[model samples]
Target: MVKKIFYNSLFLTLLSLTSIVMAQKQYPINYFSSPLHIPLYLSGTFGELRNNHLHSGVDIRTQEKEGFIVYAPANGYVSRIKVSAWGFGNALYITHPNGYVTVYGHLKAFNPAIIAYLRKIQYEKESFEQDLAIPKYKIRIKKGDTIAVTGNTGGSEGPHLHYEIRDEKTEKPINPLLFGLKVEDTLLPIIQSIKIYTEDVLHDKVLEVKKKDHLFSLKSIDTLLVPAKFSLGIATYDVISNTTSKKGIYQLELYVDTLLYYQHTLETFSFTESRYINCLINYPDFIKTGVKYQQTKILPGNKLSLYNKHINNGWIELKDNLVHKLRYNVLDVNGNCSELVFYVKKDSSMQKIPLSPLPIIDSNLLISYNKIDTFCTEEVKVKFPAEALYEDILMKYASYPAPSKYYSKFHEIHNIYTPLHKNISLSIKTDTVADSLQSKLLIVRIKDDNSIIAEGGKYENGFIKTNINNFGKFAVLIDTIAPTIKPLNFKDKTNISKLKTLEIKITDNLSGITKYKATLNDKWILMEFDGKNNLLTYTIDNKILEGSNLLKVVVEDSRQNVSELSFELIKKVP
Candidate 1:
């Protein structure tokens, strides 16, 4: 009785601490306005689970087209402007006086004054990509002032504006909805299915799941017979009104007989901790099948701040034969919730079931998550830094004969299902090749479908060395072919008087494009590179004279292979 009372008191204390932390970060609801003039409908929400990281901001839809005017949410200055071909292309940052910052991404064009200022710097640097830090006194903005126009730029998939609200000092992204930015979400989150794991998921793969209406059962059994130690996972999603797009839930709580066993809230998180999402879900299952099941139990090395409460890391240990009730409460940001209830009991008959024998692994193959370890053979060497893994795992290693085109044997360090938090140093020995071809040699990861992904590396002492984040089949390969450059518009010695822009497609076979330059009549001209389409375009301006002019373009690949194109055009525009 005393022990139970002590644990109850400790739980209350922890809950109090959590409440205090939440209260301290009280967000101001009326300080900011909408960045877009249209009704806010989110295709992606803050803290949504993405490929390898959490979605840092919300993606506001732009009615399936571009050129939507984006406004400043509050009175602030343009603190930062970054224009790039990928990843939040043409992003703008504004720092307000209320200790907050607003970010707009994937812009088609900035305001005229800002565009002129950006063009001056771009011309000075002779580069398309620019990242500038603006002073507070320059480019001041008022509430509802037009800052930029939305487009499908950077890594955006469609026409939308990626918006974010962040703490100015810490640079941590906070949910914009918490600051009174309204998104119409009136529907409850949908609970798809729930999975039960009886043992270590990596080694013993005894997983069972079933789906029913609001109630879940293992294999359709009325009461699940689980092992003494077990964990649970759920596959769920949320949806907003007037859109069929599925989104991420805001909060998930697991309760055991009315006691909170685990609680996960998607309020805010740091960018550094976003990669831990690999461990937060059933990674192996996700890699095998494209389904993501969020595990209720937390791994030791998973230090994500999403969890507000957990008892014994959410591992339920059944000591008696009494049936225990399990309940899950899933909620969206608008308080619409869906509940899942089930029952489980421990039975001695479950122990009688035959279990597969654990694989016999070499002692050195065992890797701990908190320590640095190295594994090497005669031809391959890999070094893993501390905290590289989320849990202890047995390192799997194998080698196979390489194909004729490859320079070395295919070294399978491990399966690609696992994820690494930190980069691992990989060194692979290669066969003797001509000195001229040494620079073209690099490591490539061979996928299951026999496709090759170039992992750039440098040749050092007959070995290609590179830092890789994923574990898979790696082999040394050579890339000698130059990038292909094809003109889409006017050809050599053709009339381009009516053409407003010159378009050319540049692509590389193995090593990706590294650099590209274009000049008109010996003067450098601006060519906007759209990497997604492998195209470069130069808008015809005063630089191109009305008579005969020469245009020269040079493109280079990562392996130093270069391709050049020259064209003569007659510009007789009326």
Candidate 2:
């Protein structure tokens, strides 16, 4: 009787869990409503390929204007608020009881009540940017409540509202379309071309595909054959009902001879696994031409969870002389599907392939996968963890002249076109920095666009060590220049009775600005920083007096170099 009871309990628990999962999947469609009052249009879609991560939220078009009223989609409380100069500037998070959370980002301003609350905390903290969490019931909000006003803030390039729905417990973003948010998308996906790769027992070859207007034709008479081992990749994009912009396809499926071989969908993904996009698309092609081609075949080191059902890792073996029919299905979020059909024939030339070459043993070299790999020379050392790379690659190294401001030689560890799955350890030995100024040294990456980005480093045992996410040109640079501050709206000691805001622009040469503070009459005041424009604006509040008000501003860089500006100002609200 006890054993039977135990089995019954286990079955009940599983049944309960299954029911919960089904409900979570269905709740958004039934309960949630659109956050905007107008008909919905999208500027960016969820699961789109970004620079380093998949776009976590959808960008809603706001008609190229700001200050549109943003409403709450469901009944929830304001659970969190983040104020920043970049990345979802002035964002809000609301959690509902339906096991989901809704996020509204790139807001210009919250409702008056929430703005007052934020300002009180900003004054207390004496900082413009803040991250705050509110307890439940503290800010009660119902469905359709006006939460914020939409604008092009933070990293946004234009006026739009960034919206997201997330799993409350897992914190993973759920595609909003999974809910009932209506987006008019009847057009099908456009498949530009399909690439076929031939892999032999010893070598791999990339085939050149012929391009036509819409469909790609593999020319030459049929019956052309290839190696028994082969893979496929496709370049495609989708169009919504009335938009010229091309977005990512929602689903992809591959079939060989009427049998389902592989499938992937963009329903949801965790941020931790988003970087695997570097392995999902053709990384080298993206680096060279900035085009993203989704590889239908799964690579050996790709661990993304997007692939649903795959057979033989999406590889096809043309063993017999049978003709293989290939069909690819691409779909958008709105259920618009497009299909491409092609054929592949077993080739007789594959029989003349040469035998595999013998491997050469090298004690100092290692091609690594699923194990840590290390390389060292007289002046440099690099350690790549097992998970650092999506696939095994021959470690390459070279050195060149550093840029003008750098103190060490530029190390070309590997081509930046190669994508790394995780951060790898890099250490460079140099004696250019004196012990007194070691704290100001940093490893910098020279980007293809000639922009310098700081890769934080520290001095240890006569070597500057850091962890880098990309394989690129790197060198040690010293940041001794302080930030530059220039007043924009007013001159020094000028009378400003009509002006309502004091605007200034601040910038740093290298190792970007770390901290900034503003003071009025030797007391703290709130100053808003806009990172995209490098502008700081301080509004005239009660904190400023009538005449001869002493205003001071101080800014610090990552290297602790400080810049200060003090001037007298007059403010009068006429």
Candidate 3:
């Protein structure tokens, strides 16, 4: 047994060394200027832990409002311009000649020249969302040139600029701060709490941390008694000089008896590996307590590239009853660091206590992460892809009678605490309904708060099928209601050419809006759709006639429910 442990530790050490060498590549400093003219502060950090993914770039705060001029960082060509209702709403990508790419997202608007070019395409395509790739010679940019204006567009919660630097070839985002963009941060990271996991324990234990004289220690506990094999997790965050926002730490190192046992740095990571964040964090704890704890131990399927060093996958095994010193060092990108020291002793009387067996249900199935599997009940069927799960689990499932307003039984496939890496195909058998209403049938996930979220599905052979990434209570619900369209600025025949822009609000209660179109005098007009605000706006341009104009708008929901609004207005000015 001792020989096996030693060999495993040696193998891990070699792997760690190889990773360290791979991550030693130096970043060029001062090559790119700050995207904003004002002082830069962070609302979200690169590699920060987010829902089901790591934040790919830093979010630069915009003073809680929009319309700040965004400048080009360096000489580059506009490589890509993507405008959409969600996810980076108005994003611009610039590819430099030096094989690097800079991305600016969540912009309110692009400069006039770019807007003219983009509007031309939007009018041609008759679509509000577009992803266009510009030729290298078409739109060239120079350093410090005004490119865009910042806003809280897309999936952003507030006014901020999501900035990124990437390798042009690989398209993987690198930390923008590494390029010499600076933020004032002299404060060290705070160690909030720690969790100790033992091999023989069913539930891990959490301990709050207290600081004294610039060092952190466990509150009211000098030493902890644990079994032979154990691991650790920490809830830590950093703060900037002027902001109260808690940001992710840049680096974490764990030491056992003053020897480095594990370390991970927030450097560059691939987009494909971002979902592995579910494995890096204590997922169940996050779902339970809403606190994300970065676990020191690496899971079997966690292939994230952030770990630069580790020994035995960060599992420390005590061979004797001697008390061992454990230490954690957490640091921010500016090199401000905090240290926590504690002690643990191996329990000499410890024995392997067998874990209680999970309750055996007739429909329970063992799902493995390495292979695809399917589970079925009388009214429901689920197909899990090989990558859907992070580890093996004994799936617990149940079913209850259909609730009011539902067409199918309330099927409980699994608990929501466990996270899935990929979408799983789910098909639920529905009660007999009129064939005409089948088009309105869609699956809805019931949240813990009793709110229902639409998970659109298609009806096929008496079943409503959908692909879902979360596990929870789901049932078939019908949405026969069309979206509501309300004019915010002008109504039918009430405009006299004074309004600079026409605004309308479109919304749906159940199934979300899928498509919308606006036309003036039977010609397609460019109307920007903001899904977050459920508002569509069209700036009055040369497209409107001087005397009279007919405006028509059409919108549709996911269930094909349609809404239309038509109006006529006088435009006295050209």
Better of 1 and 2 by lDDT: 1
Which residue pairs collide, candidate 3? none
Per-residue lDDT tens digits for candidate 1, residues 332-385, read: 766666666678888665553455754745666777889999887779888889
Clashing pairs in 1: none
Q: Is candidate 2 or candidate 3 better by lDDT?
A: 3
Off by over 4 Å in 3: 1-23, 359-364
lDDT by residue (tens digit), candidate 2, 306-400: 88778887778887888887766676776665556667787766654665653534444555756888888777889888978877776667787
Lowest summed lDDT across 10 adjacent residues in model 2 is found at: 206-215
RMSD of each: 5.0, 8.4, 5.2
Best by lDDT: 3
For model 3, the run of ten residues with the poorest summed lDDT: 12-21
Ranking by TM-score: 3, 1, 2
Instruction: List TM-score per model, in order.
Output: 0.92, 0.89, 0.94
Candidate 2 Cα errors over 4 Å, as ranges: 1-27, 200-224, 351-364, 400-405, 448-451
Model 2: pairs clashing at backbone N, Cα or C within 3 Å: 225-347
